[model samples]
Target: MAKPCGVCAGVRRAVETIERALVVYGPPVYARHEIIHDRHAVDELQARGAVFVDDLSAVPDGAVVVFGAHGVAEEAEHDCERRGHDVIDATCPLVLKLHKEARRLADRGYDVVVVGRAGDDEVDAIASRIPGRVHVVSHLADVERLEVADPARVAYLLQTTLGGLDTVDIVAALKHRFPRLATQDGDACSAVHDRERAALKLARRVDAVFVVGSGSAVTTRRLLEIVAASGVPTRLVENAGAIEHGNIDGLTAVGLAAGPSTPDKLVDAVVARLKMLRPVEIDVLDGVEEFVRFRLPSRLRHAGERSSPGLGGAPLAPGAALSHDR
Candidate 1:
């Protein structure tokens, strides 16, 4: 079997950890969205009694809900508290860092332009905090006529999953227009940046590269651009089913990679589909490995002290509700 991408492997491990701690009860363990944008992963969880809902109203009162990798807005958090629901925040730490950065920039009087797809939850949260001060940009040209209250005080924040090279081009355009714009120290997640780099390494050795991820995923789209920059043929597909055999016709060697939120099964499916077209040799390209891990909520660690039960299962201890604030 071919090796899985590091991000996909990490996400799978995280979900498994949560699964082991689950306790069946009211509403069947509600999740706010597709846990990690991988249909196979989400479907597997659904089969295991996990219920996915997009809106708060869909969750019954007092249900234990888990937030997806995409962090929910403060308003969503407030709603859960008001409804007396137990909440487990499963947002990736990198995304949380981006949210905090956006809030800090806006608070410092910067006209923040949160750029990504229009409907993505990450973009929505940043937009909600500073409505008038926030501007949304999708492409490099979108920055051409950016209308900020103060051009000199403009700043930019990106969705953690954005393509690396695409962000560079946008930042370059923004600098050309407003020379004084500031950005966070690290604009994109390390996993995304490293995966794009790995894809490029393979692209140079092959004529084409295939990126497996959902169409709406930002990181997967970026991998295509990174490969195309080297003048190689590249295709971005959600899974093996979307791969058009005609596109890779006559290509000697092909590179394979997936987005941070993609699952191993989808990558394997792509490898199997490609085999039907040609006897392709799979090269496991090496790149950076992420060792990042986030701590469970404090209340979960000391459940006995919680006055009320928390997410997944009962609080780690009784009368431990105070630690849930973290």
Candidate 2:
């Protein structure tokens, strides 16, 4: 099983923020993206009257708005200000930290290279913030083709949710080319490394592996890549309902791995389906839960009237986009 199986700290923070906003702001709180990758989680919140929209234009004048774990770009931040929506920024602290590092280097006249996937929302958002020439490396080969204004004035930033040997190798290439490459400390996601290792270990002892998560989420794709690379059959399922008997027909042992954005109920339901499919012993490997905690925006954190009236009701001042953190 995905040893450290639960929502990752960042995703957990986003989920909690939306939940709290719904409680405080009443029905129809708006989120610009799916926020939580798991459809089940979104569906549950939707049933509770949370409205998910594609753009700020869809959000009404008085509704509270949330930015998902995949941080928003500066352009969108400007839109929020114009719309005068009370905003709760749920961008993962790790992402915010990386964004800060990118801007710090860029502001100092350095060309920044971001190690991340193309078309990934978070990567796209990160790239949007850098005002200079920015390069995004999706593969190790991309490093060879990278050209910066000055190798000495170059720094690198990692996609907050990405971590693997490839990133290490690419960063190594950058260092080899630029003697003084400014790399970020603690940019790698330990959650990704831990979950991938757990899934690979489970793959060794199982006939097949089922990764519970949305394929759209980057973490789930990484798990499938690692598991499939191990030569074990792997299937990405959204929940227990996606499981088919044919997929596990002849399997005696099945490994379960969950993406960081996956919810607990999704994993639990998968485990239950596997057990119900046959009379087999189930083993959940020992796991230590994630220790990190990202504080929510003061508005969402005090959804219980602790500063409730001041936080949710008032539209952010013309220039204010995100609420101040506690």
Question: How much does candidate 1 score in TM-score?
Answer: 0.74
Top candidate by lDDT:
2
lDDT of 1 by residue, 1-326 (tens): 11235244224433643454364343378877666666666676777778878798899998888776666777898999999888777666666677778878888899988877777777776676664488888888899878888889999887766666657888788989989988876646656667777777777777777777776655666666677887877777776877777878787777787767676567777888888877877778666644443444443444222211111112223342221122
| Per-model CA lDDT versus the true structure | 0.67, 0.77
Native-referenced Cα lDDT, model 1: 0.67
Worst 10 residues of 2 by lDDT: 305-314
Q: 229, model 1: CA deviation in Å?
A: 7.4
lDDT, candidate 2, 1-326, per-residue tens:
65886567677777778888888778788998787776777888899888888777888875688888888888887888888988888888778877777778888889899998887778888888888889999888888898889888988887867756447788888889888988776635677777887888888889988888888876788878888999998888877877767878888888888867787777778778877777767688876555565556776555431311211122223443323242
Which residue pairs of candidate 2 clash? none
What is the lDDT for 241 in model 2? 76
Q: Which one wins on TM-score?
A: 2
